[model samples]
Target: MKRQFVTTENTLRFLEGFSALEKRGAEEACLMVVDGVPGLGKTSIIEWWAGQTGSVFLRAKKEWKPNWLLSELIEALGQVPRHGFEKRFKQATEILANKHEQFSMDRRPFAVVIDEIDHISNSEKMLETLRDLSDTLELPFIFVGMGKVRTRLTKFPQIASRVGQYVQFQDVSLDDVLAMAKNLCEVPIKRDLIEFLHRASRRKMREIKEGLSSIERFGAINPGKEIGLDEMAGKLLLNDRITGKPILVTADGFGGDNE
Candidate 1:
């Protein structure tokens, strides 16, 4: 079973561009910024790419102190000589440069996915450091952030200038959601059912997936049987009881859709 939300074309373009840069030369690691509303699956898309391309992925979190970000990178690259951020980044870069000698392709094609970058990207210093790394070392880097991120990034012209690719994740379309449901949930859906849920979900993947999950739960109770509209209407979180309509389930971030 395909346990993934389908990769949209805009996403595929970014992935292909990243690969093209890496395969061509040292300059391939130019900065990429992925901006989306919360729960749009930016991290999932990047991690999936990492698995396919052998790129190193680092997730930056809310509690991650500024220095810790650099420290972790240093440690991961086998170059943590000391605790200071600048020292560690310097040593790591040197070692990576050394390892990229004539004998082998650079393993340092590493992509540091700075998760939640919007938290610190507005900080002038941090943005400059990332910009410097991308400019000087030409490191492969990605910044993952929420809706306000792209707007925030525009504040720093220097950093914005280095961005080779920018991606804005739109909500999942109806066709894609239905396809993922039929293929991933092992449920052959009818057109009416698809329309019913699409109206309720506005085509968000998380919402549609959860609805399918509800369907699976229904099937679990009535084993080896199809979960038709009646069962869905009663047990599913989608239906509006009083009006007899499917209630729109809004995504309150974290990628899950809710009624």
Candidate 2:
């Protein structure tokens, strides 16, 4: 399979949300929330975007406290974390403020992304600290989680009111699956196979990639043939993560057990 990142409708929506957050009128309203079910590619896309934009990305820990978050932010900003929580907080804000100014001058979108934010979403202290930092610096903070962050944020009206954009990742469409196969697969795949994979994977990005890998391997053995549903029949296309069995393509459709 080719090493690539395929832009889908979800990615475009996320970019739109970020653009809206960047152009927000109120400084204090600088928060963005992105949520989706597992296997939808929320973390994968956010990590890719962070790398491209030079944004500081932190994965929230189950036991995260305000001080731990501050320390992580300080280190991510390329500075040594100070001993005391207050000192670390000050350091993080100063560095983030400076970086925000630099990004503004360069016309680049800058944000602090907290992935797995659900871990800390219930902690009022941690959320309050994040809210305080964003409010103080007028910088954007993006919270990425597995479908609950949006509802959880409502508990903190102060934080919820400050959210400038909310992006919910949805199941990939057949078009998105086709784009991924075209960009990431090593060999040509027919529309029939692509559509089958889309349905078999239930439109999940992670499962679609797994199915693509199966097609790529089959294509490699065939050498230059465009793989289709017929060619892929009786082949293992995806693994049933819940059942620990291979899902094989059959003449009529797919089944959890191998043909």
Candidate 3:
């Protein structure tokens, strides 16, 4: 693979927590709130975990109504292949339960991983829908998205307080960035390039990876001896697409970095 994921120890620890929740008794199943900036590898981690455990993965649309969203969930369940209103719901729930003719009391419960949950973070109807499915059928589920989920959960205290684990995923560090850059590009990145990238990316993984690739391409094509800050600036200045000027960034830290 292109090594998009950083796969740090923190991510592994969070996965361990997920596994513990899944293996717990039915009554003890829990929800999770994974808060992070966009493209911080949150979705990738969830997808990888789902793949590793043979669980189903579903992403919440940027905007969705309850019925449309429910249909999307049903579609993800692999039950849309069946026709009709009556058969669809029956088949959907059945497929979600791993197609077991009888719900196994001790069987590993199916994991329903929902991403972009914060889209419906304030919608009680949507929240209640998930809560009802989990409570009535006693299903195992996990939700991943933006914002402080605890605040959103206040709308539904029943669901909010039931969350057994909460984790905020973040970007890969600059130290990890250089190694990933070296590994992916098959070339050593100069310290200045790394420092410039660290400043530009603000420790955001996707931005760092993209910045590294841009620098590597300049190195390969421009006949440059080494990738450095000036070369990177010439080739890929962080310019606002709307304005034709180089972006000026200052880091007083996230507390108040606003220009």
Candidate 4:
């Protein structure tokens, strides 16, 4: 399989939401929440976005406190963390403010991405610290989490009200699966095979990628032949997300022993 990032519908929606957040009138309202189920590619797309846009990306730890978050933010901004929590917080905000100014002068979008933010979503102190930073610097802060983040944030109306946008990533569609196959698969795959993989993987990006790899492996031996569902019958595509057993392609469709 080719190493590539395919642009799916979710990715486009994320970009649109980010753009809207950046252009919002109330500068203090700079928080954006991105939530989705597991294996929907939220972290993958956010990491890719950070790399491409020179944004700061950090993953929230389960034990994260205000001080720890400040320290990580300071480091991500390419500075040594200060000795005290207050000093670290000041240093991080200064660096972020400077970077935000530079990005503005260059007309580039800049923001901080906190992946796995559900870890800290319930901590009022941590969420208050995040809100303070955004309110102080008027900078965008993206909080990426699983489906619970949005519901959990309701407890903190001060933080939730500051959310400029809420982007929920959905499962990939058949068209998205076909696009991934065309962009990431090295072999020519028939529509039937792609459809089977889509259904078998339940339209999850990670599972689809695994299925694509299986097809690529089969293509490696077949050389230039176009692969169809028949050619992939009885081959292991991916493991069942629920059953933890290998899902194989059948002549009729796909199923695992447990299913």
Candidate 5:
């Protein structure tokens, strides 16, 4: 199976939200929040967008202090890290301001995406810094966190109000499953197999990848044959949630036991 990024419904929704927020202009709040359940490809979508737009991507960590965050932002903007928290913060802003100035000439927009924001969602200082940067730079600051991000932001009403767009990702639909299979699978997969894989993986992108890989392996072992649930009925396609290992449930080993 080939590894690739498939544009599902979630991707389109994210683009729409971004376009809407961008249209709101710098006069309004330019912050965007993308909160979704784990394993729903939120990071993937953000990374893709950042790559396309030449945006800076930062991953927040639990141990990140104010200085650390500022330094990261500075480095992401391709500036030399300076000493002192105030200087570093100012340097980061300066870099962004210069970029914004250049953007004015070319009529291009710049954005920054901070992923795993839930790690420091409780840090008032960090959130305040983000708000200040968004206001000062007047550039789009996208926050990517888990499902509770919107609820968590309520603690900072000022920041929450500035959220021009908030996108909540949901589980994959049947069409998403089909699209994923078609993109990853090299051979023609039967509809019944696609349905079975979708349900078995619970529509999670991570598990769906695993299930498709398993199917690919099965197909490789048995070439020139249509893959189906019967080939996988006695084997494990996904891992056990708790143990992180394969869990196979077969009927008495195909009735080999004494009856």
Candidate 6:
């Protein structure tokens, strides 16, 4: 499969949220929350932003503690882990502050993005640590997680209050599907077929990619046909369009499947 990253409308919204957060002064809020359903391309946007801004990016583990999180940040800053939690926390914040200063002088944005944060969202100490880091360093901290993450963070009022921006990713629209198909598909795919795949995948990014993979397979098998919904006859378009459903086996009994 061709490697591609399609910047959809949600991607633009995320960029705007971060841009707004970056423009804030030290007295203003620096923490941002991005939550949505699974497979909405939150992680992709996070990585893309991190790459563009040269920010530290980390993924929270289920067993992570405050010290582990601090150590990871330290490591990302090109430093070895310190012995104690306080030492690690201090070192990480100092490094981030220095980097933030440089980026400020260069008129660029600097941030630390944490992905898959649902696992650590319930830990009060972890949440407090993030808040402390953002406050002390005066650098933006972005948290990406599933839909309930916003509600889960509300359990910690202090942490929730520090959030300056909240972005909820919605399901991909037909236009988004078309853009992705145009960028990722090896062959030309009709607009209606793109919409069909979008609805078939339930507008989830992972499943939408799977649907594109199926289209690629069909194109390779039938080299001369223009890949479209009609051309995909006797082939699976998606695994299951809705919940508690069986696999969509084509009427002509093709072996291909989509998910």
Best candidate according to lDDT: 4
Cα error, residue 76 of model 2, in Å, equals 1.0
Give me the displacement of residue 60 in model 3, in angstroms. 1.7
Candidate number of the best TM-score: 4
> What are the runs in model 3 whose C-alpha is more than 4 Å off?
1-5, 23-26, 81-89, 99-110, 222-226, 230-234, 237-259
After TM-score superposition, the amount by which residue 147's alpha carbon in candidate 2 deviates from its true location, in angstroms, is 1.4
Q: What is the lDDT of candidate 6?
A: 0.81
Better of 3 and 5 by TM-score: 5
Q: Estimate each model's TM-score.
A: 0.76, 0.95, 0.75, 0.96, 0.89, 0.91
lDDT tens digits, residues 1-259, model 3?
1555556644775687776776666464467677776756677777887777567788877577656666777876664545554455555666665532233544534577888887777888777767766664566668888766667787788888667677777556666666677667645567766766666665666666666667666667766477665445545624432344543322222221111
C-alpha local distance difference test of each model: 0.62, 0.89, 0.64, 0.90, 0.80, 0.81
The 10 consecutive residues of candidate 2 with the worst lDDT sum are 250-259
Ordering by lDDT: 4, 2, 6, 5, 3, 1
In model 4, the number of clashes is 0
Cα lDDT of model 1 by residue, 21-96, tens digit: 5664436337777877754557777778766655556776566665776777676666546767777667766764
Worst 10 residues of 6 by lDDT: 249-258
How high is the lDDT of residue 12 in model 3? Answer: 72
**Model 4 lowest lDDT segment of ten:** 250-259
lDDT of candidate 6 over 29-120, digit per residue (tens): 88999999888889987898798889889999999999889888898889998899988887887888899999999998888999999999
**Clash list (residue pairs), candidate 6:** none
- Candidate 5: tens digits of C-alpha lDDT, residues 71-158: 9889888878999988998898889888877876787657889999999889899899888888987788999999889999998898
* TM-score (C-alpha) between model 5 and the true structure: 0.89
